[model samples]
Target chain A: MADLIEISDPADPRLADYRDLRDVELRKSLESSEGLFLAEGEKVVRRAVAGGFEPRSFLMAPKWLDGLADTLATTDAPCYVMSEKAAEEVTGFHVHRGALASLKRRPLPSVESVLAGARSVLVLEDIVDHTNVGAIFRSGAALGFDAVLLAPRCADPLYRRSIKVAMGAVFALPWTRLPDWYEALPSLSAAGFTTVALTLADDAVDIERAVEGVDKVALVLGSEGHGISPRWQHASDRRAIIPMSAGIDSLNVAAATAVACYVTARR
Target chain B: MADLIEISDPADPRLADYRDLRDVELRKSLESSEGLFLAEGEKVVRRAVAGGFEPRSFLMAPKWLDGLADTLATTDAPCYVMSEKAAEEVTGFHVHRGALASLKRRPLPSVESVLAGARSVLVLEDIVDHTNVGAIFRSGAALGFDAVLLAPRCADPLYRRSIKVAMGAVFALPWTRLPDWYEALPSLSAAGFTTVALTLADDAVDIERAVEGVDKVALVLGSEGHGISPRWQHASDRRAIIPMSAGIDSLNVAAATAVACYVTARR
Candidate 1:
């Protein structure tokens, strides 16, 4: 059974992981990386527990503790029960959901491991927006994409905002970082994957026609402003574009990813 | 030629449309049904002008005015040429793109007119996020969705942030408010359209298999927290859901819209 501790003081050192969340908690410096990965709200916390991420500590209003009893019975972490007012003071903003948990970050799977036996994959190039990254993962997981591979510049999928925005899909979806994307491409191709680059260039085949025959496919998506670089474009097996009406630039990168993933995945 | 008016003072009455944009501009009630529709950057401003929403006025750095001279020749609106500093003060933020245009809100098309001859349509229910709404428009337009019908709770697509995020697709896409959604469904069915409601119910058919071979379709998407209301669920001709992994809840509304629109549109 979990250790239930009553916390009335907002300055408790054990509550440090949940403190000043809107500002310091969101920081991504090397020092803050030692801080716990925040799982906000009851739904995500329950998911984190289910995913085998043992909670170091939990802070929540007393009312919320009732709903979490079943999950808490199996955990050895200390659950810091606090008043909603005290909880708000420790955390910078109002946490309306009345619950939060901090878990230690675990080692991510390697690209090779995630890609093993995968038929369809999404390779993101420098997707900076956390929401877009999360949305892409949600869509990828939903549309039957086996794995997601992130290039160096992409936002961390484990980031708190990304995790929440992805509705816990990030926890279950297989993903890994490829520090050197160029070198990684050929290995993916050698593994029987057809590399499809998504771009707006004139010579690109219509996405509808591009995915008609390929069974094993890797869909490459680029950032909103600057698309996939010339090197990747040149190395791609085929370029596919979702046809648009004239005068429109392009769909949001995440939206485009969903369309591409849906089109390429087998129904 | 556009009348070139020089303004140095931030408090100038002529600059009212651009003042305190972070606060006043977002307040819909203050606009008195004649709210300013802002188009930022050179690209969106040009598109807005070409789309026939006459610019009421413009605040721009002198350097940008010279580049826009050819396009400005036909407009009668006064072009307020200001120093970069003054433009930033007037808008309450740095004018990074060096240009901004304020246009009067144009009348939205009637639902009947927007749906006329539409083979595929999207109905958005209570999606209040501006960026999500904007991305949905971009995806709908790109995927060849002929029209979008919005429920009353939907955000105004002409909001400034939405226009910027949408990259001006809002101006190009056909969207209108459906005041009477229940009443509109019979007409939609009468016009040979299959009303497909997207949900996560256990009995719902897979969206990919459900949409195939449908001639005319209306894909209905709901907000993030609450899925489609029971009213819509009961009214729909078919209930369909995008197949998702076991632990995942659902995709972002915009991402789901893209996937649904792509699957339902005439290929």
Candidate 2:
């Protein structure tokens, strides 16, 4: 069972993993350097443990201890209990759900392993928003997308905000970063997957028609501001557009992914 | 032509509309009481003016003046030119877009007016997040949904964050609050719409099947936390669900809205 240690001082060295939660750059560097990612809230923390992530430590208010007792019993990781105020001081934000876990991130699985039997996959290229990345994971997972392959530059799906926004979908869904961004689509095509790029190009066909009757589909999405890079756009087997109203900008990347995933899943 | 007034003081009364923008409660009350709404970024500012909203005033750095010169020439509203630092001090956040417009909020049109000749509509109930509301508007508009109807408690679409997230799609979309929440779905049904509630009820059919062959669809989505209320769920003509992977929670309301809109628009 996990040991419950009460911590009053927010400056304790043990609490370093949870400090400066609001500092994106700091957290990114800290998390990567330490090979750790944080899962916030009761549900997400529980999911992290259940998803087979080894917890380094946990932080929560005393009142929250009982709710997670069963989860704590499964791990020998130290659980630091503190007042809500102390947690806020350390995390630089209110711990509304009152629970957090810092878990070890395992080495990413090979792209080939994740795609072995997957019929539907999401390929993200430079989607830099953590929340957007998280939301897309949730949508793709819920819609039964088999796996996700992220370009080298895609936002970290394991970011704290991404974890919270995805409600731990990141843990449940199979995902790995692409080792080679340039050859990502062509390689998928060679692996018997029809790569469909979601773009606004004039030659783009309706999404419904793009993946219709296609087996082993790979749907590609782009960054927030500029869409899929010209290289990937040209390399993809098919270009699909989500038939939008005239003069209206495209849906937000997450929303577009949801719609695209739904269509691809159904197809 | 608009008057160009240079202001250095962040506490100036004329800049009240743009102050404390990060505080939701403060901005809501201030905007409502002053009969105004804020549009951030150069594009949103221009769209707000082009959407026929009367600008009460414009605030921007001197460097952004040339870009909006043509727009400012069209409005008689005062344009307050300030340094980027001064703009940040007044807004409580960095105004990276370098342009902000406080536009008059006109009285909302009747639900009947927005529904006239409308085939596809989105009805939101108690969706409190400004970003979600804005996203739904963008998705709804992009997918060719004719109108949006929000329950009385829904967040204001014209809120600065909402406008920015929606990319000013809120300005182009015809939306208004439903004065009567309890009778919302039934009222839409009475107006010849198939009130399809997006819920996870046991009886909920696939969204595509739920909206199939429906002439006029009023897709109902609930709040972020809970799905549609019991009353709204039962009052709707049919319950629809986006078929999700087993054991996964439903999509985010905005994502659900995007999928629903995409399906309904095609129907």
Q: What would the per-residue lDDT of candidate 1 be over residues A164-228, giving only the tens digit for each residue? A: 88777777778899867776667678888888999987789989788888888989888877988
Q: What DockQ do the predictions score, one after another? A: 0.65, 0.93
Once fitted onto the true fold, the runs of candidate 2 whose alpha carbons sit more than 4 angstroms away are: none
Residue A174 shift from truth in candidate 1, angstroms? 1.7
Best by lDDT: 2
* Docking class for candidate 1: medium
Return the TM-score for each candidate structure: 0.87, 0.98
Q: Which pairs of residues clash in candidate 1, taking residues 3 or more apart in a chain or in different chains?
A: none
- Across A64-174, the per-residue lDDT of candidate 2 in tens digits comes to 899999899999999999999989999999988999999999999999899988999999999999999999999999999989999999999999989888988998888
- What are the lDDT figures for the candidates, one per model? 0.82, 0.92
Our tally of clashes for model 2 stands at: 0
lDDT of model 1 at position A155: 83
Candidate 1 stretches greater than 4 Å from native: A1-26, A30-32, A71-96, A212-215, B1-15, B19-26, B32-34, B60-74, B78-98, B201-203, B208-215
